[model samples]
Target: MDEVLIVVGPDVVADAGLIEEIAGREFAALGVRGSVTHARDAAHAAELLRDGAVVIPGRSGEMRELIGRAAGAVVWVDVERVDGVEPGEGATHLHGRGLGGIAWGIRHAAHRMRHPGRRRIPYGPHRDQWGDLYTPADSAPVVALIHGGYWRSIWAADLMEALCADLLARGLAVWNLEYRRPDLHGWEATTADVAAGLAALGDAGKVAVVGHSAGAQLAFQAAADGARVTLAVSLAGVLDLVEGDRRWLSSGAVAAALGRRVPRGAQASHGRSPHADDETVRLYIAASPLLRLPLGVRQLVVQGSADDLDLVDFGRRYTQAARQAGDEVTYLEMPGDHFDVITPATPIWQATAEAIAGALA
Candidate 1:
């Protein structure tokens, strides 16, 4: 019987049945009777690799070890990317990178749901126009937390509640900000919320903005739009909107956020004063933080080595631009996946905390 063994790390075991079906269909299309098999660990995977088995792509250390033992002949067979192979509920189909992002989103949501914030403050009349503030015993600089889910409506700022609590425990006042997702009020509403939150927080002590993914984009724009920010930390930020559109990052996330495809170097004027208390949506493609340079504020760009290659590249481009434009910018790269930058328990977050302290100091 003709068979092509499939090797995957521990995470894939839960969905082994779905993967088997996808693999079988793909192999059959290639004129072979493929039987799916899951290796228990890196050692088992190495044995399969030596026998010409196909290894599924994953960011797990075991998977990396197995790939290293393959002696450079490892074949990557991504059944998830196969056409007509739909990922299960709460799963992202089509690309392993997408899967990783979706998994993190789900985990964040679950974490947030389990742990509520200390207090909720409303910045606007809209239901989503509120911020959860986590206060320490003694007041400290306000660090605004923006969560990112490709700017989609399905994600909310609550996903960062865990991080907010951690920051508060560490002696920092946190405003876990939530703005309407682009699908609801468009990108303008998202930026408007950022502006409103910053304005409402007022100029009290050091105001540092820490945003993840899409939130990073808004934080930078808010700072440029006059947020009185002393420091801004973009964790896995989408710095270059034009480049993101070209690469189709997060599957057309930029286009969705902007409501259209914007060409590079297109100028735009959007949004209102961050101190304004009114509700108005204004979106401009030219407002991309990558183009708004020399922000005159200390900045930190944290890029994960295991994140999407496109994001890593975006961080590099942004760092270069900031440096050339004479902005005080520190680009730090850590070992982890795209979501690790937001996970407060990881060493990456330790590095992030240090960067925050350095920027404020």
Candidate 2:
């Protein structure tokens, strides 16, 4: 039987016992052996990296060195912050998820062991420009999933893992994408990466782009800009950048994402406010899905009734605009939160999956 190791950093304040308990449960369920150890320091952590799958909890620059040495998969769990140290290649990272992140990492490691066909395919040279590809034995329609953390680097392709698994189970190819974020990279790079990611799936049949939150905007922009997308699905997406910026959604996440710099004494005007700079306005117009109507592709806009009111508003308005612009759109607004649309077990996602299947048909 395969054995997995859970290494807890000495400085980490989380409950190691609880993590072990969780890891044990997960390993047993996956038919893998598991053990937990507390590392005294960086050297100790490195020493423990010689064997089966490894799950390291806590952020440590030293752990990055051990990534190449691990014989099996490496999963890093950062319980504290989103901007924690990156483990680079040969490692999967789960950040800002607290203790649960450890469990998730373990599960991910186990999944990698169980499913050898799952592959990480790179679309660009940069470390972030890649997608996790999951496919069935037969050829199927591709579903490219774009995750969202308001265009921040913290959230990544891992956000869509559950949905990827769900879609693959339903006999669809899954591409959980990761791209450069505007916060670390420039907004242009972010857009370019999205386009490139979609283009990488050229040979994959009947591509459907499903993006959540900020990713929804990217997905829509890709479709509008003439990516090879047959259907575009937006889940609680920030479709309208101008209004999202004006509303100061997520404490001004939209402006920050667009790299907006509002000059002093600049006044709000015509859906372009707070930052009326010409370049900023141009960016908003180009990036926003609401502004880019008649995307010329079938669209499925799913909004949660209990999500951020701004998002709900954007979804509804965008659907209306798309329909008026002569675009085929299917709008689904139901009782759910921002995340329910992505959770495979939820009714909203069931409805969404059905809609996507029908559209792809």
Rate residue 236 of model 2 by lDDT: 94
For the record, the alpha-carbon RMSD of candidate 2 to the native fold, in angstroms, is 3.6
Query: All candidates' TM-scores?
Result: 0.65, 0.85
Shift of residue 131 alpha carbon in model 1, Å? 0.3
Could you report the Cα RMSD, in angstroms, for every candidate shown?
A: 14.0, 3.6
Residue 241, candidate 1: C-alpha displacement in angstroms: 0.2
User: Cα lDDT for residue 269, model 1?
Assistant: 26
For TM-score, the strongest prediction is: 2
Give the TM-score comparing model 2 with the true structure, all chains together: 0.85
Q: Over the stretch 1-50, how does candidate 1's per-residue lDDT look in tens digits? A: 22445566655534766666556555554344445556677666666653
Model 1 clash number: 0
lDDT of 2 by residue, 1-361 (tens): 4667788776777766787788888777657788888988878887676434455645465654555453445777777665635564566767776676776677667666656688899999988999989989988999999999899776777777778878898889998899999988989999999999999998776999999999999999999899988899999999988778878999999889888843444343333455555666656667888777879999999999999999999999888888998999999999999989988888999999988877776
Worst 10-residue lDDT window for candidate 2 reads 262-271
